[model samples]
Target: MMVDGVVARLRELDGELAPGDGVAVFNGMYLAVTEEVRDRLAGGRFDDPAAVAELDVLFAGRYLAAVAADQAGRRPAACWRPLFTARRQPGVHPVQFALAGISAHVEHDLPLAVVDTCRSRRCPPQQLSADYHRINDVLADLEARVREQLMPGPDPLEAADPLTHLVGCWSLDRARDAAWASAQALWALHRLPPAYAALATALDESVGAVCRRLLTPLVRRRSGGGQDQGGQDQLECSGLPSA
Candidate 1:
């Protein structure tokens, strides 16, 4: 139903975004991955297409809400603030912005989305596990492409690079596993509204801490206007600064 049309709205938003903004870098990659997921779901690759589609929509709404909040001069979620605040810092690599956005979305919004979808669909978290993991599989596949395309140079990232450590700190597989656990935890705590709310607050704050580190400015800018082939102005590794 709305699944086929969802990409249109994301495309429109991507078009409206300013070039070189950190959010734009992440949103652009997200748009591509969303397109891929939409295509696979439409092609009937998922075990429960309807369930996955609904989950996808619920998950996307969080990111859309953050963007709206920032545009309206309200503070977005703590997890998203790093990307929004550091968008034009000139020293942060685009990949850091992209990963930070993913970290915020997956670590914070994703578990809540899973719980919300379960409540809306009148099912337990276990019922959605099959298709939930399927969607994550899609995300994991696209993440490699996102990193390859957004790395600040034509050369592959060196093994000893500091950026390697930054990227490694947020592993996609581990993030997915943790998100599922959180979803199950939230679902269990839902009947205790106060407990649910407290855990949710903690989740938001903790994920924000991780994302803030991921978005920490990782490079030094050139004194002149020299630019890399990646079109970024980053010149060399600057020690990680306090975010």
Candidate 2:
């Protein structure tokens, strides 16, 4: 239930930050939390439940503080503020988008890790073990379904939905490799405490950008070969950079 605890804490924070100011805040918080967890795990500190709890508290507190500042019309106070603000708006709430992205990442790893750890425990609770196994099974099935939907076909337009295609591509096991590679690039650019700041920032920005590109109509038009004068005018109107 280690990952369950993490997910629970994230949900609690999400609830606290309801009516989110925008995706930037949520991205910042999610990156902060996950990077904390990842670092702790990498450092072997997550073996102790108490340590994990402490980490959760620290992350939750920091995220809440940032959210409060955001709500007050003050800039977020952190190294990643510029990256977060790149896509955020003054009034748009990003809570749901952030939660979804974070949840997807968690779903991709945490539950499976919890199940494995529980199975290896000397005196694991049977009920908890069973619950984790079920969760893992369900996730596997869902991933398989998503893969089936994403398999390339003769008609390229059949996979025109970029959001679905992106999700499917990243659902593969190799997505972790991509994420790690990207994190490494970020690390090279901006070193931070515990060597995790860059990794977290990278994940937050990459995920946020992907979501915006996939879900925003402005992005879709640019990708759909709409390069006529009207399309150019629309692009200028939207203030998006040229493709």
Best by lDDT: 1
Q: List the candidate 1 regions with Cα displacement exceeding 4 Å.
A: 154-160, 221-243
Residue 210, model 2: Cα distance from true site in angstroms = 7.6
Task: State the lDDT at 147 in candidate 2.
Answer: 40
For candidate 2, lDDT tens digit of each residue in 1-243?
Answer: 344455565566556643543444444455444544545445664335543344334434444454567668786443223323533443112332343333334322232233233334423333333333333343344345434442334424533344344344344244434433443344343424555554454455555444443223223234344666433221111332111
Error of 1 at 43 (Å): 1.3
TM-score of 1: 0.87
Q: Which tens-of-lDDT digit does each residue in 107-157 have in candidate 1?
A: 889999999989888999999888888888888987898777776465444
Report clash pairs, candidate 1: none
My TM-score estimates for the predictions, one after another, are: 0.87, 0.35
